[model samples]
Target: MPKKGTRIVCFSPKSSSKSNSVTKFSAPSRFGLSPKRPSFSQSVMDRTLELAKPVITKWNPETTTFAKVTSLFHESRGEAKDFIKCVHNLQKAMHLLVTENPTSDNLAVAQNLMQISMRRLQKEFYQILSMNRAHLDPESVSTRSSRTSIQSNSTSDYDDDDEDVDEVRVAGDSIVQVEDESSLAMADLKLIAECMISSGYAKECLKIYKIIRKSIIDEGIFRLGMEKFGSFSSHKNKKKNMDWEVLDMRTKNWLDAVKVAVKTLFNGERILCDHVFAVSESIRESCFTDISKEGALILFGFPEYVVRNSSKKVPPEKVFRMLDMYTAIANYWPEIESIFSFESSLPVKSQAITSLTKISEYVRTALAEFETAIQKDNSKSIVAGGGIHHLTIDSMNYLSLLADYSNILSPILADSPGDLPESSESPAPAISRRFAQLILSLLAKLDGEAKLYRDVSISYLFLANNHQYVVVKVCTSNLKYLLGDDWLSKQEFKVTQFAANYERLAWSHVIESLPENPAAILSPENARECFKRFNASFEQAHRKQSACVVPDCKLRDDIIKVNLLRKVLPVYREFYNKYRAKMGNERSIVRFTPEDVGRYLSDLLFGNVGSRSSSSSNQSSPHSRAPQSKTSF
Candidate 1:
């Protein structure tokens, strides 16, 4: 009031305070621990207390000099006590005001302050009720859920200011009220999904997984990713710009999302299936974006989970596919020599090997393809002709788990005990020979692969020089019919030029153990060795037949020649007729024990000694010369 043009500024009390009351001050911060004034004039203090006296005069103590003491006691207890002298002086003025004059302006100011305090209290209550969690209703949920939905979709990274809004966010309902700020996209949703799974929001993760899976699959991007070969920049149809070849950002997000969710759902595994091939193929393509060591590790996808619902083993096609996935992983991540790196992570090693063990049920294609691919790849590398061994050997690690697979077959056969025909001369005995021959062929092929890996190519001339060198040791505690030296010499293989290397290496040194008729070695001797052991009941019948001494008669030899003709001439009947003699069924084909049978066969066809089969000279397979109907088998 003393300063002529000084403006009076009053700020209302803040909402955060404990109570509402009349507060007077020259400045709003007066009671708020502000710095002290240099010197408050006594006159100013006296005037302010005097000024407050008239306003507080209505409060009475109902005693003598009560009016005079009004300002000291009628005002707030704390303020009056702290400046009791100011209050005492004000009490004198209050007595004068009560007896003489009153200030209407003071009464008006108190009324205005009471109104301000009430309004503040009402506004605070409204806000508090609006945010109370338990107070939310279903209608309110729907109303607010829309807003929350919008916030969740918007990738704003959770601002603290959102907390004010989050309180109003009831699940299951809420309008998506996106503000002017930045928002998230579908791709962002995928990223969020990944984070949730990593941090163990299992429930949230599964929910997000379903959402993204539906989205990506509906968009047809999953199939697209699976089929799209990576490294497109190096492809024959290379796009002019790298951007053109790059996968859509959405595809990438979908993969990261689904992979994380799938991993979490299975505790990080997939059921092995045909789709796993595509999944791996997809992963390989994906890592082409960033082929760092970490990227390479991830590029090799996880083995899909395989479950056997029945007592029956996993199907061959499915098993083959699982093996394919292992091969793909091994081939894709070459920087890590062992993609599994079992030594580094026992859990990973255990899981991977366990996965491989499941594939042990079906061994044929898995073994053959794996063995072939490794040998081919390595040989290419050694000779400096083609691709890297890294590509093939990577596959071999998964394949090698099956080193124990073949033995599984042995027990199954032993437990079931399939009957062997009575004589090598029986029709069923031919079937046994064929089966043994097939096993030999399989061993030979496997040996060829192993030899290629071992770098045993000293020269072309010394091939087939190691036949009896234990190509395979099938241990039924060693009742195994091994590939003896005689078997290798007598039977010329239906070998490819590639396979001929092993044959040559194994057989060149086989002359030392060569028998005149090695085929005879296949049969158990009925003479001194096994008449009693063959079981006297069966042997007596054979002894009465006098089967051992069928000399090389012309008629028998002619019959054998005819049997050979029938074996080889189905496609060449025209040429066989030009030879202008005759052909007939194997007349002696059933006459003797298989041992004598084999002897008669060699002498008749190969001329006594130091000679090869007349039929063996014609070196060609149906594959090389012409196609034939395999239905004949």
Candidate 2:
């Protein structure tokens, strides 16, 4: 048999037989929605029909009984096609109808049929979606190439010389010849994303996105001017009039660029993030007249489109491709705005206040979603398709967003409502304990620096100031929507899962055993205790993981290495501070970046706080405080 949970029921009337027909055939729409209409080309229909024989044989060995009793259903693909062709044959006189032989009602009827057909096609698509097959996997885009059709009538393919005023191109002859010719193929990828949304092909959309954004890092285009919004349009009109390196890109190369961009950012590619941030800044400067510098920080590397530059006489669609590219790069993330950076554009004083405001907004959103998820138990609705089979992506994304938004709560509480900290004043909060206390709940399960959501995770530092927040839950009620049932339960250990469950055991065995609330004075002891627990957990998970026997010895070693956190003292301290920092704010928890893990650990194990930080000595939060013996976590 296939994997236990791998099988999905084939609803072909023949396989269902008489006893099962009422549930499978007569009851067509499970959600009260109309049956899905087939598409114009309807490429999957014949294929689905071909698949029916195998599926029926596998699921209903009693199909012979149906044949013997009655041939009531059109069980063959040819019969189904004949029925459809006959239904459309009446449209052959459409030209006569156009000549005033038909009433407006006739047009309306035709439109309804079209709509119904479309809807049925969509339904068929979703039926297949129930399987969550590899054809729509999130990491691979070419799984269904045979069925994925493209319009060949599109404009030029490889004209490298046409870098016109509106276009952009890279200086490469192989990808395309002219920078001016917009790639029909590249546009197809973007369109594919849009189509996926309509077709409920979200997983495929994500795959297309991965192909274009972060899968390949060397492609400078992915790292090109993203962090900035307006910079894309700011290219001197002379340059706009000049050829855009943007055009000469082949579909594969364009996807290569995008995949590289997102992959590196997710993989903690700090340098690439820096590059995206710079471009994001340029894009903003070109667009937002009243743009705040703080916005640059938060919005950097967020996936979005370049808006129309009215003053520049640019059409909005012209920026569509850029946005498409950016979207393709950053589509996996549901919430893509930069609330913190939006406000922190000015001095430390005002920036702090502004950051608090954004943090509040972010928290509000997250709180709402988290509450809804809890109340409705909507995991099933969140992840409905079989393609990713685990719609756990949203729940994990929402969880990480919760952690990030909760991160800044402490800082917000630490600052006085009326006054901002002075340049000469200590950067540490006046009431670190309260701040830590408030954030502890939010940071309870935080294991590592990054806010990963299990198999799918991303770490970015372009605008290191951003915080995440959730929008709404997957469903209003679990019964109403078929969101994943296991969303909330399984994601409790998001950070640890990303860390291969090492920190989970570490924290539970050690950190959670400590006081719930710790005073500043006792924080040092708590930190040590937490560190000890972390080490223990790491060792335990490490040993068990190492014991696994694989044909390749390196496989086990790699598994340990990939999941292991090299214990460095300062990393513990920063990790501790990050935990502490979340206590007061309880809303704005920053996800850990590799830099936070790498740099801080170096300082803890060795005294040197790398020169990479401009204010190495002035590290803002005092994470070293540790939990007091009497305090509760």
Candidate 3:
């Protein structure tokens, strides 16, 4: 009925005359009117289309269960299975139609049905993704992926040819089990994905997948409190002006978020993408990159932003947070590398590495700033009683806490040695060397603080107090391990040296006032004068030294007291006993017997002990004269 070269229009069963849906087929050859037997190939092609049409039309997006606002895969597994099987059959029919009967009228019908089927599958894919978001969440999907992998590996000994068939059969059988909804959803998605991709609608399938899954990831990151630092126009201004309390909270949140993002969020997406698009490596990588790359960049980029936007002088406390970020990235590098292994995902990897590099640089800079702070401390107020300087306590506390992170700082300091002095006495790790340098700088600052004291004896006491405190702090904490026993021993010796300096400056004049030889007899006037000089010097030294403090009992008893007793006690005792007899009734002029002198020395340097008043001294020696002049040391 149609002319040569004319086209015959084929419409879907649901199409009306007003519908634009139509497929065109060229008119068959005019010579085909001769009643000839159909070839075996033609019969097979016809049979293929006959078998595929009912399932294809039944599951069509317009007239079938797919049109309803329900997940086809979730509502009925049997129907979902039939739908996938129908698509496979339709693909076979298309292959046969193209090869055996390119111009057959039924070819146009098959083409039309195939398009409808793919649209339905696309809709179902989107619905499953949207409706089961919680089930398909990263944590759930990751767990299912692990379980699926174990099952696959356990049955791998089966023939490779049966693997695909077995996978489909297993997916169907598992749908009836009381499996978790996430596992069912995952298997259904994978099944539909393979079917659509094999049927040449990969673009449509991937588009819907990326749209839905990427949104889920973006929303998940939002819920996890990952902010997009790039959205701000002035990172430097934002960070510089931001309150540290707020920034610290954000940094802590970032730390928590990054772990979830990498280990669970991105990892699950990678698994789901791989499983769904298992037939094509390229598709899997591309899909996963599209779904997770932006979120990952924002997540990892937070640390870099914090570091880069920081004021030129980041607080020393900020270094600890920076180290936290650095340690996080370093600890999870294997996961990051594995998850973002694709070339397309390299930006994410680069962002994480850049964060690490920038954080390390900032940690080094912040530490250098901390050292400079110690070096530049200019407070002039001396600690009363020559106790430890405030600067010493603060610096040592900071260093001891810093030492807690030595495992983290070791590599960082090693990378940029800076101007940190290397110890020639022994080979120390870079962090140890840096710690040693920092402590030395603090000691130098304490030395400068020591000069603020007017009394030379008090200055020596100040140095001794601070140095002993430093040694105690180092020996008690992780610093002891970093700065080895040799260094510790050397520091301990320095403490002793300071203590000795204090002892000598405080008591040398008192010892000198006694006779060179206690047995050397002199004139009675010389005897009275010797007693006068001894009383003047001993009272002056005892009163002044008693006001000073030795906080550490060990240093007081073992070092300062021992050195003083060994140097002053025996000499003073001999002078007192020899002179007490010569002074006669004026023995009270001696003012202190050997017992009194030893007791006073024992009480020296305990800060709590008050100076002996003139009234109390006079009461002890009722007849002793008030000295004609005050002694100076």
Candidate 4:
């Protein structure tokens, strides 16, 4: 301290380490003998470090201490700006101290404090977003008078920040009376976004970024650094001086945020909500820009918009939503084409078709998974089975509508993997033929599933029920248009075949006692023996088959009373009446008259077997040949 111009400065150690440390410096000696004179750079560094000390020393990152940050945002007049000011000062001080003393232990403490400050700011931003989600309608924000109206209301009710604080709006959409306001707004957003990024809250940063970009677009500001619409300054009309660089940076952030949102939306575990729709719509809107116009469908909004990571597990819901979104886009092809037509672009249709192929792959994958589960343990499957059944019906209806409305399905069905013919003159039959093939494949899988049951009667009954449902749906619904008249008749024929199979499996023994030519069997001993066998067989079939489960009540009645009984009872009556008198002394052996047979048959299958008079004169059964099985003889 020999020189008169010397200055004494005290430097403190890191907050977590020794706190009170001193550093001394003196100017160059006048005698010109001292070599360690502090340089101009050293003096400036010393001043900045000293200025940062108090902030570092008093840094308290506890949530309770920072709780006021969020409170100030919600409760203060300046919104995020008020909160940003306090935390930003500390952050700036920390940065200066760290930059000056890079290797010092105190620098680490400063960095830690900076991180805490950033996280606190990010936490507050999220709170604001969550609180204001419902109020974030674009139309409301776009209206010029909305903010002033909000301000008027908020001013009367609260002492703190107005309720409508930080309501995001585009620059030109509303005229703010105050000058340099948009620039200030952008500065605050950039600082807050930096804090968000440092805090590991990429998602929060994206929300702010989206707002900024939307503002840029709404304000009619040039975002891509090009002037196709006009010079950036021309739109300003020299009314308000604006910083184009800030807009440029915000545009970059917006693009980056879109990439992040795409990856997030592809996650299956998360529900597809309004947030997802909003992000998707924004990205889709951005596609028409010169920067993305060329490969917009491929690069931003289609099947290969983002490169898929195959190793990660994608949820089915995510794929389903992607399909739904692509379908929506495809439906809007004409409109999108009209806009992009100036560029000579026809990518929407081709890209949309690619997306449909991807959707088909997902459908195939789901079906495979379902089939595998069924194969593993068919009895344990309830929800999956029922879901697939419903999916089949719904998918058919959906595909039919797609075909009828747009010619979209025609290409898909025509190019659908392998089974369909090469070309067809009629679109309806082509789609029908392909869909029928798919349904047949599903039915075959279901048939195999039914056979897994240990009870043969139940197995056949299950097949009957499913087959009947499908046939009925095809006959009555729009499916008839696609499947054609011949397809409907075939399905009906299949239904009849299933009915015969169910009867053959459940009641063949009952019908076997009737002779091929019952009139030829006239001997008393033979007729008595045949009558006894008929009664025993009928009783056995009735007891076993009655307990079988048919979940659909209407189907149960149709198969049993209307279809099977009508085909069996009249034949039973002819055999019984012819044999009743032939059993002379063994008349007591004739347990049931034709009337009793009819009543018992109806009562076993359904609850009511009609009146005795109604039963005695039976309606003729359909002349169906007995199914070819050993039990049918």
The whole-model lDDT of each prediction reads 0.29, 0.30, 0.73, 0.45
CA error at residue 284 for candidate 3, angstroms: 1.2
Full-model lDDT, candidate 1: 0.29
Residue 145, candidate 3: alpha-carbon lDDT: 52
Candidates sorted on lDDT, descending:
3, 4, 2, 1
Q: Estimate each model's TM-score.
A: 0.19, 0.17, 0.81, 0.41
lDDT of 1 at 60: 24
Worst 10 residues of 2 by lDDT: 462-471
Q: Write one digit per residue (lDDT tens) for candidate 4, span 189-239.
A: 334544444334444556544553334333222233222222233444543
Over the full model, what C-alpha lDDT does candidate 3 score relative to the true structure?
0.73
- List candidate 3 segments past 4 Å from native: 1-37, 64-71, 145-179, 228-230, 234-240, 415-427, 512-534, 566-587, 593-599, 611-633
Instruction: Please name the candidate that would achieve the greatest lDDT relative to the true structure.
Output: 3
Off by over 4 Å in 2: 1-92, 104-115, 128-133, 143-633
Error of 2 at 589 (Å): 82
lDDT of 2 by residue, 1-633 (tens): 111211111122212232211112345586787665423212222232333333223222233554333221114433323323322322222223334433434444443333333233233333332232232222232211211132222222211233211132332233433211222223222222222233233443333233333333223332443333325444445333322233323222444543443342222222212121222333222222122232233233222112212222332223333333333434423222221122222342242334335433333333444434433432332111101212223443434332332233333334322121233233343333322222232232221222332222122110010111111222222211221233322322342343333334322333343334433344544555554455454344322322222222232232233333333323444465545543443222322233443333222211122333465343511232211222111
